[model samples]
Target: MMALQATLQHHPLLRATLRSGWRERWSFSGDMLPALRWREGETGGLLPQAEEIDLRREAGLKVYVVQDRSTVDVTFQFHHACCDGAGIDRFTDDLMVHYAGLREFGKSYKFVPTVDPNRLAVRGAYGLSFFRTLKRLPGQLVGLMGAAQFWGRQPIPLLAHQARDRCTKSTKAYPALTSFLLDPSQTLALRKAANHRNVTVHELLVCEFFCALWDWQKLYGQYSERHWTRMMIPINLRDASYRSLPALNYVSSIFLDRRGDQGGDRDQLLKGIRAEMEVIKRFQLRYTFLFVLNILNGMPWALKRSVQQDTCKTSVIFSSAGKTTRRCPLPRRDGFLHVADLVLRDIDGLAPLRPYNCVTMFTLEYANRLKLNLHYDAEFVSEKQSDVLMDLFVAGLNQVADTAGTQL
Candidate 1:
């Protein structure tokens, strides 16, 4: 346990080396704590996938929940400093294990491995973090151009692109789906294809994802100027900075704005991701502290806020290692939505080196069944539009699998 906790503390990716500006460590006292708790978990069984109440933080932070329901609702409090979406996921997974008697809690749940504490690689994402300058304009522009050129080319047709026509309006209502489950077999097959292609799974997946989107566009080029949903990929620090120490939210979301297929061909996109990834992988492991020294230089105050709002604009955010939503589902709550289970597993262990774009499915898990939660904006994507998206998502999944030669 000492080793695990220490490892948790020591890994650079696990630790939030970024200064929180506050002199004092965070305190989770008062109304800031959870407002409700259930003595018996919502699940009739030993473990549930997602707990109710939908308590989470911004940019997918992490929280610890304990049900001394007899006590006040304030028991489940979290320190925003170190916890992240992945971290929360890990906590929930372990909690469920402990709850289910599969894994003991506390003393029973102590295992630690050695880790290196460094953040330079992960820190480099903020290119402006270097040069002590305000605008990362140069790097951003270069990266943007490279990314842009990569995407400018079209590979897939449109009608099959599920992301199109769905986000004309934003959703803040209940989640549209229950859970995002991966067909481990399908994922494995895709990985193998990527390996055979000599490209990364992420590169191939991104390529395939874009191809699928393009295919949809070809069918119905709704607008004269083609614009699709901007995708976000979470870069995990495991391969680059540190090895598998369950760090909560040890990830960063990199935006890939495809204005009519900017990704270069099969060769270029893979190369760019690999090049960028390699730089990060090297910098984050040993000299992340140096990168930290440059942050204030890279991003000034106003710019930082803009970045936060644009990139981290999810209605709910969480991090878990595994077994997210394993806790039994809770009754519905006001002002809250369901869980978004994002599974980005390299089931085939292919292209661990190349970066992959994120594929997230937001859903509601009730009674051990996963349902997609679609929060729709009445104006643009009506219930009808939401339905279209649902159908398209199914279509997209199937098409992608078929394209990758898998039995959907």
Candidate 2:
């Protein structure tokens, strides 16, 4: 705990709070360390209580430590407006380094924070050239026209029949989470399968998610022509130059739009996804979303109005925190990462739920194993249905692995 406090004292963004009123800004606060919460019990059911961190009154980040017997689970909850998944990974790496040093050197250990002045400069991180971004405008405009399929028609919800309320009435939205793990051997099989298909692991994961969700919805009689299933995948903008930056939001996203009637075998789906991703990469289209956001940032009223009028532009968000163990500076003990006296067993990345987009999926690879976590609005998806969705996703990956074993 003392090590964490010492680390936070050096990180500016982690010890900052938002200013009130329409024009908001972050102000550094020295007392943020006291807000850390500690509890006793196994961490289960990722649901946020109403009394958790309030960004308006408190700092932008909150840390919770839950201990059960000899095991410890640390959960970090932060406002999405402040930081991204990669940012959290960076912070965790720093925290582990500090903890290990403190344990070995006691009070003699000194903490030095990473310094990057351009951390908050999003455009700088992307190295966005005016002429370069402008040249891709036409292609992006065409993509926007394609995204119109989701404008008029409502995107299919995960489990609409199980909604507890017609509309989410809580002042704060808390996502309920369920997770499953893939052993190292299974993880290797999936990677080999992706290699066999000539697609990246991320593209393969996206294909499986789409196919599994399609099959699950068809089983429930929710498949139709008019409804669309649009998924948003966030792209981290930080490159090698930004490696030393602290935790902050430096991310953009690409949207994949597919109609409900577009069902096919896994190979066909993977092919289509790979082609689209190729176009996105060739054109550097992820920056298009950031360009629009930059424009909207100037007009707070229009931004607020657009969000208020949002009609489920996205059905789900799929984010991957690739190879988390590579970013940490911790030693391994019995196949698990260790920090001081505690053995780090598992790490789950939980994506925040949006207003109309009730379901969010996250993938994190740690210690040669892959873990999939699903966070959904309980009001929109039932607990049983969430379990079924997870089963379908895992089954899809297992089938791919089984096929790879026979061919390769």
Candidate 2, residue 248: the lDDT equals 76
Global Cα lDDT for candidate 2: 0.75
User: For each candidate, what TM-score against the reference?
Assistant: 0.47, 0.88
lDDT of 1 by residue, 171-243 (tens): 3332122123344566555556667656655554454444444443344453223454444444444443343
lDDT of 2 by residue, 1-408 (tens): 887777666556777787877677787777765366788887654544524456767777777777788777777777777678888888788888889889889999886666463556553437656786677787777556544543555665654533233354544356578898888878888899889889998898898898788877878776665567889899998778778777778789988877655656667778999998998887667777776666676885776776666356677899999998586667886558888877788887788777666678999998888889998777767778789889988888878878667311
Q: What lDDT score goes with residue 206 in model 2?
A: 91
Weakest lDDT window of 10 consecutive positions for candidate 2: 159-168
TM-score of 2: 0.88
